[model samples]
Target: MNFPRLQGMTEALRLTQAGQLNDATQLLQQLCQGQAATGPRDATVRPRRVIDLARALPKAIASGVVSPGPAAPRATVFNGTAARPANSPMPAGAAFHALTYSGPTGTRAYRLYVPASYRGAAVPLIVMLHGCTQSPEDFATGTGMNVLAEAEGCLVAYPAQPASANPQKCWNWFNANDQQRDQGEPAILAGLTRQIMRDYAVDARRVYVAGLSAGGAAAAILGAVYPDLYAAIGVHSGLACGAARDMPSAFAAMRQGGAAPSRAAAGQRTPPAIVFHADRDGTVHPRNGDQVLAQFGAGLGMKPERQDGQVPGGHRYTISRYRNGQGEPQLEHWLIQGGGHAWAGGHAPGSYTDPRGPDASREILRFFLQHRMA
Candidate 1:
């Protein structure tokens, strides 16, 4: 038994018993990494303990013994970040709601779903940022990410873009001002992450961010700005990097289109990335896919290596691994053919979603599990 982890666990237990739910949650997460790496016999002890602790947290908060953490930071309200408050209640395990720190522009709304398998111990967190015109609920329904999270014993968080910020509810990815590392929405989103850490037992090393369309662009920007925060990023049917500038440049760039400069030459702690774009994507265009793939390859300082053609889905999918100039991958690319501006292999909910072949959710999870912050 490693005493440090055991000590942390003891503190967590004491905090829980004392009704310090938020503190206890944070401590438990700190203890999880050490315990997760332990052998079977030792590992079993930690998770069981966490389950016992979770039952008491809600009670403590309800009894006024422990208050929820500070208000979530405000954000730039977009088309759907805000909705009639997630009052569309579902069963307990169906969904959980929690507000996080807001930014100067607007309030940040988030939804966390804990799988039945989650025992309150450290679990991977998947921050799914939604695209424009989409609310958290709509994204949840469209991506079917909840199903995958439940199967994998991971927690899912849907960070909403309040409609107040942008009528389209899209992440302001094209705004160059917002694209900087940890400035605008990125900073607010990081604050949301802190709130999540304070609220749940998240595995710090396994945190991941993924987005669709505008959301995808935001995810890319996130990995660049807060590379140390996210272990990996997933971009689906989105534009390349540098999509935003200021107000004027943003609209002009979006309308005229631009390429994400090759980040291959730069040296930063950029997290490994996974991009899912369809060659047939009409909205974002297939050329954007090439630019993104090339950017990753160059950023990693490695020549692009294409894989055997992907079949059966009407889309010829190609995966290229980028090894940094030092033979390390700072990025990765997944080009799906015949796929459109929708979640690949998604259900037939609408024309934009593809429900036939490889599951994008599964692939992204697999990719996340394979890498971690340097």
Candidate 2:
């Protein structure tokens, strides 16, 4: 650990011992942000690594300060109870299998949805990462991705983020370790995608990834770091890759807006991207949506073809489509007017959904199908 980080931690420990838990948490968050801004002095040191609050503080203090708050009730298959209605009834021959993938980083459980129409033929694969405090079933139900998969004969994978990794079960997109290729969560998720492709017949060029909130941010990072693995990405209410490097910065980015994305490297081809964000989002500032597209090169002097539409008896929205030099659509951004921080046009059974907006799932899948790896 860096000397300043160590000193800050010691100060936080003292504050915690003095029964100032909130102050300690704030201090720790500041320390995290400072570390991210300055980076490590040693090249070998990984900056913005995930902090283990439990090991750093008393159990009570860690429990209260580390997590945002008490998570909502989690939906578990073991209990045989439904937290929400199934996204849709499974068609005959369709299968939802729970599987696990272990890699050098760690092990994670994931759920795969195989559409009924899938035979031995190769089909497009979509990896869906759920938001914080959400389960695969809940996300599948909320986003209605599996139903779309069934209708379109696409394979969908939902990677589960356990509470052990994050108390809120959020992808650690803010951490430097988790943001890089072949490291932390990115490696696990990419490995999982490859494992699915190996286990089932999947179109190599048509593999895509999408997610909501923290998962959405993770999707952006994955697209940035592993463009060869994912042909396209869908980020709903997410920030740009490298938007923030720690908890304080994450919170700041969510509240206001994050720093501009770093320029893309030479010879790097960022995957085509589709982003969705509400103009009225309270939890995540809508500016983050623009940053997401900008990270994909949307801000590189390319003009977008803008369109506007409204859902029947629902929210109005604006779409800005950007094209590459060859006139190929490269980025699409959806801004839902009067929409909050939830999945647009999502089902009611799932958590954090706004049913009164355009169906994000349908649009995202359509966008994904339009592009593939060259």
Top TM-score: which candidate number?
A: 2
TM-scores for all predictions: 0.68, 0.79
Please give the range of 10 consecutive residues that has the lowest summed lDDT in model 1.
48-57
* Model 1 C-alpha lDDT per residue in residues 82-183, reported as the tens digit of each score: 211212334355555665677664468888877777667998898998876677777776566777677778888898887666655778787776777657
lDDT of 2 by residue, 141-167 (tens): 888888878889999999999988987
lDDT of candidate model 2 versus the reference: 0.79
- Where does model 1 exceed 4 Å of error? 1-94, 98-100, 103-105, 246-267, 294-300, 310-314, 324-330
lDDT of each: 0.62, 0.79
Candidate 1 accuracy as TM-score? 0.68
In candidate 1, how many Å is residue 87 off? 18
